[model samples]
Target: MAETTLYDRGMATRRSVLGDAHVDNASAKMTEFDADFQQFITEGAWGSVWSRPGLTKRERSMITLALLAALGHDEEVAMHVRATANTGATPDDIKEALLHVAVYAGVPAANRAFKIAREELAKREGNGQ
Candidate 1:
């Protein structure tokens, strides 16, 4: 497929997984300066890797949560935590992933991640989401 074609597919997948509100917000924030970067992520990260069929979306969600936590990407981690609902990742799944993070990514990171996840999960629960 052409690069633009692939990017369009990627953007669609990205919006479906991350939600249109979040994707629209991010798109609104993109300036001329960061446009390339945004496109890169849409085309590369979402299109190239995330679109692969090797893993279920649920598995991908778990891996994404663990990696984001390990990298201290709290905001992204929180976003993905919210995405758990769409991806069929349960609180139990998140708990198990966080336990893995605690072992490999360190207790501090896991602790902070757990707090963020709890908050997001509670908010979702409150909204009946």
Candidate 2:
């Protein structure tokens, strides 16, 4: 059997969670400046962390949403919220996580995150996702 490399695992995991369109768009936009950065996130975030066995993708999705919301990473929060469909994380799960973000991170951050999440959810609902 062939040994799967970290980048390979990462690419697969990233594609599964983020979906092909997002990955392909990002790949199409890749350049010498960000090539290494992309590789690093694939290997580190997707391969090392997201591909781990202990947590369900659903659980990880919740945790990721909370962290991104707490950090006020608006775009990342939006992306991960969309990713919830693939991760099996429900709208309620996102609500709970953002509630934690409000308490632990601050109300302002959570408030903004809630708006983004609501918008993303609306888009997904409209698209029949």
Clashing pairs in 1: none
lDDT of 2 by residue, 18-120 (tens): 9999999999999999999999999999999999999999999999999999998999999999999999999999999999999999999999999999999
Total clashing pairs for each candidate: 0, 0
What residue runs in model 1 are displaced by over 4 Å at the alpha carbon? 1-4
Question: Could you tell me the C-alpha RMSD of candidate 2 in Å?
Answer: 0.5
lDDT per model vs. reference: 0.93, 0.97
Error of 1 at 31 (Å): 0.8
TM-scores vs. true structure, each candidate? 0.94, 0.99
CA-RMSD of model 1: 1.8
